[model samples]
Target chain A: MLQFSFWDILSNLLIATQWTIVLSLIAFVCGGVVGLILLFMRVSGVTPLEWFTKGYIEFFQGTPLLMQLFLFFFGIALFGVEVSPWMAATLALTFWTSAFLTEIWRGCVDSIPKGQWEASSSLALTYIEQMRYVILPQASRIAVAPTVGFSVQVVKGTALASIIGFVELTKAGTMLNNATFRPFLVYSLVALIYFCLCYPLSWGAKKLEGRLNVAR
Target chain B: MTYKLQFAELLPYWDVLLQGLIFTIILTLVSTAAGIAVGTAGASLRTFGPKWAGAIVTTYVELIRNTPFIVQLFFIFFGLPAAGVMLSETTAAFLAMTINLGAYSTEIIRAGIQAVPKGHVDAGVSLAMTKWEVLRHIILNQAFRKIYPALSSQIIIVMLGSAVVSQISAQDLTYAANFVASRNFRNFEVYLLAALAYLLLAMLTRSLLRGLGRVIFKAK
Candidate 1:
């Protein structure tokens, strides 16, 4: 068995962190697109669309993300379609992120008073025009903090993808420990790296909330 | 595509599933109670304690909140053992979970505590109440009521996240799902069932917590 120096293990784990970063970016961006669409559908004032989106959110949020990843990875394979771990992880994280993002954005929209909607409608504005001109502009401001906060969650969510053989930070730590026989050192570094990735987002969310609260 | 879906293959392992579900419930309940107590103490200490104490609480909260739960679990279960602190898998799982939940609740409760006006707390102190008594009787009740919904959601979140404990062979719902799936080679069916079980568990836990909140806090 070849010995891996501490530097070797640390550098290797750092390299795998790149995949974690990439997966997080993909999931966040794609989920944002889908979440925005879901948010529009949810608030479209169409009862069917509202209920459908609500159920979609409920189904994803109410279940464990681990199980979701498992289902996507294993379920699709059962249908005789081979899915790469990257694909499965991306699919599962995207759906999971969208469900949460929609809910957060929906809350922001809901915080807008009913009068704004009525006033925009009275001006002979269509639903799209009202939201474009009056509602989402205000909502998006409040949405910023929560969206940043949830991005931290999305980053953490990508760690779960490691279970499905996506060689991200957490998985890299596990592999390093097995190779180096240094569980304490390896996992502590892993946790530290995660902390480094997450603390700025957490601090930024707090600052945004403080600034926005002052602005309001 | 007419792909056969055979949930029927996993039916015979209902007892294992039940055992796993019970462990999940027990884990959630134990950690929820302990975590709330820890969080309430941490919140009060941070809010009312001296500089050093507050710093300690802040450190604890930040450490747990910023890291993923799975890493924390692995650190405790696997890392601690390497450092000469052996723990059974279940004990490590429970400790990791309680610590995780406590940090989150500390933040939630702290926010609620801050929203309470200082004058009321001062008035309680001026009326010959000890600081502990003021916090316990006056601040705790009102703050809990204000943050109750957020707290309820967090509780369910912790429960759903307990599925990750299966990685350490905690014999929770996810572990049972994995066991039967491997045995029967019915991976999809077992996970689908397990996922459904978690959904029901999430809904049930939410309602149960909501009902408890109503009874304890009395309706606003």
Candidate 2:
């Protein structure tokens, strides 16, 4: 029997942690793009688009991420699609992140006064011009801190991918625990790794929020 | 071969799903009650207690907030046994959910408490009210009222997050979905039903919390 040393576990976990980071980055970037589109649909001043976006956000927000992951993983099989855990996790998390991002951004955009819109319209700016040149610049400024804050959630959300067998940090910990029969050390380290990954983002968000508040 | 979604195949397992749903609800209710109590105490301490105690609570809040709830559940369920603090799956899930919600609610309630004006506390003191009385009557009531919506949202989030407790075989709704799916091989349909059940539960829980808020805070 080959005895696994502590370094064996730690090194393996560190390698698995990279996958978590990569998944989080992909989800956050893709989700941000989709969320921006949803945000536009929400605030597009078209009733049908606004309603559709509202329903989309409500569905994703009201359900658990675990359920969403299961749906993507198993739901794809209904069409005989061979969905990999990585792809399913990414798809579920992207939609999940997008719903939240759109909601967060809608709040930021709404905080911009009606006067800004009217002012832009008065300047003969089309909707796209008004959004691109005037509104987004200001809204994105307010959006920065919370957006960074939400990235913590995206990072944490990647942990659910492990349930789908994505072999991320949490899954790697489970595998190591099974091998080592040391659930205590394994899970504590797992939680610690997640903390290391998330705390700096939380701190950065807090600091940015403070700076934004002071500037306001 | 094309697959058809046979949601009706889950009919025989409806009772299993319902039991799991009830367990999740029970878990949520008990955890919410205990969690809010812990959070209130935590927020109060962080706001008014001694510096060292506040520091401990801050560390706890940050630790729990920064980590995933599933890992916390795993630690309590699997890890604690190695250290001689053995807990059943349900007990561990309860503990983890309470701890997770407590950390979040502490932060939320602390914001509400900090938002309460200094003049309010001073006025209570000037009236010769005891410290306990001041906290109970003047500060907490207003703080709860102010943060009711946020508190409601957090509770719902916790309820949704509780779905993961099934991974430990805690018999949550997701567990029923997994069990039924495994038996029937209708993974998609079973999970679809489970997801819809969760969505309904969330909507119902939100309105229920809102109504309870109205009744509790209707006085002033």
Model 1, runs deviating above 4 Å: none
Model 1 CA lDDT for position A58? 92
Query: What lDDT score goes with residue A12 in model 1?
Result: 94
> All models: lDDT?
0.93, 0.95
> What CAPRI class is candidate 1?
high
> Per-prediction DockQ scores?
0.80, 0.83
Q: Which one is best on TM-score?
A: 2
DockQ of 1: 0.80
The sequence of per-residue lDDT tens digits that candidate 2 reaches over residues A160-191 is 99999999999999999999999999999999
**What is model 2's native contact fraction?**
0.91
Writing each residue's lDDT as its tens digit, candidate 2 over B24-123 gives: 9999999999999999999999999999999999999999999988899999998999999989889999999999999999999999999999999999
